[model samples]
Target: MVDALDGRYPRNWAESWDRVGLVLGEFEHAVARVLCVVDCVPETVDQALEVGADLIVAHHPLLLKPVSSIAPDTFKGRIVHRLIRAEVALFTAHTNADVANPGVSDALAARLGLTGLRPLAPAEGAAAGGGRGAGRIGELAEPLTLAELTALAAARLPATAGGVRAAGDPGRVIRTMAVCGGAGDSFLTEAARAGVDAYLCADLRHHPAGEHLANDGPALLDAAHWATERPWLDDVAAWLRAEFPVDVVVSDLDTDPWTVHTASAHKETHP
Candidate 1:
């Protein structure tokens, strides 16, 4: 499993601060049942235990930062103890998977039925070519108004409490678009440079988004971070099942952190 993952999503492709790859367990242990999830939190861990998963292949790492201890009393430490006791291994494929050709954004783009795909920010060195990069730019099968595209995105990507919102003219037509799963405001300039009609991502800050629009960048569609990335779990699961004898199960749990969303009180009453 580790070898296959390494070959497909090499750890070297991850960013310098990213703590990806195997986080726990002896990799040699037989893994007949595997659960793929966006986050490896207590709820997903419970799901893994309930499903009798021998290994947990998560997108987000449980330990991204240095920790002094792993005692059961602590929050993450408690999960560490639970996994250790249950003999379930944990592995993470974060930025590496994001940069893979048919990667996270590829899955996101596929959900929107995008065509003629190319990297939004092309990579450098060994992983440069072969469609490996940060985000993706592609032509929509057909053009749609910005509002229409926002609705399509909401209908296609995994449903989240926060839903989807757009930051451009509701009637603005969109043909080509760029997409990056998770927080992707960092690529605002790249999307602008590509001159796509729109860009879809998550966690778009108010200032950055407003500024991007001021510069006449691509229209923005911001969905929940977890919702944007959930499609990749399905893609990775299909690949894992095809390549290995393991039973790959994708988690249905929504771990987006934002559980409830509603219009502001003023808007609720005034509108």
Candidate 2:
């Protein structure tokens, strides 16, 4: 299983600061069922156990830093204990997976039916045969207003407490779009240079988004981080099913941190 994932998304492709590949469990252990998920939180760990998954192929690494201990008292510690008790292995495919051919952003673009797709910021010395990048930029089949694009994004992405938010005129036309599956504030300038009509991504901070719009950059669509990345799970699961005999399952549970949402109450009715 490790070899299969590394072959497709080599750890060498990951960024310097990223901790990809194996997180927990042993490669020598036998495996039958595998679960794919966007995050490796306590809830998802329980879900994997409930489903009888022996190996979990998570997109996010369980441990990014050098932890001092795995004592069960800690939050992440509890997750470690639970997985260890059940003898379930955890592996991550983070940024390495993002840099792959049909990457995280590629999946996002595909969901929106974007065509003529290419990397928004191509990686340095990316593998031969043209299949690596930081984010994706593409064109919609037909132009739509920013309002229409917001509606489309909400429809396409998984429902979340943080529904899609847009910056720009509701009536502004959107054709070419740049998409990144996770926090993409760093790509605003790249998207602008690409001359895309809009950029759809997650975790957009107020000041950066505001400044970009103020500078006449592309229209912005900030989606929930989890929602934007969830689509890639399908592709990952499909690949596992084809490459290995293990039964692969994709967890559909919402794991985004924000759970409750409240909008301004209708004034006329309240009054």
Best of the candidates, lDDT: 1
TM-score, candidate number 2: 0.95
Residue range 26-108, candidate 1, lDDT tens digits? 97889999999999999999999999999999998899999999989999999999999999999999998888998999999
Report the Cα RMSD per candidate.
Answer: 1.9, 2.8
Give the alpha carbon lDDT tens digit for every residue of 86-160 in model 2. Answer: 999999989888878898888889999999888888877544347578789889989999999999999988999
* Cα deviation of 191, candidate 1, in Å: 0.5
Error of 2 at 24 (Å): 1.3
Instruction: Please list the C-alpha lDDT of all candidates, in the order they appear.
Output: 0.94, 0.90
Colliding residue pairs in candidate 1? none
Off by over 4 Å in 2: 126-129, 266-271
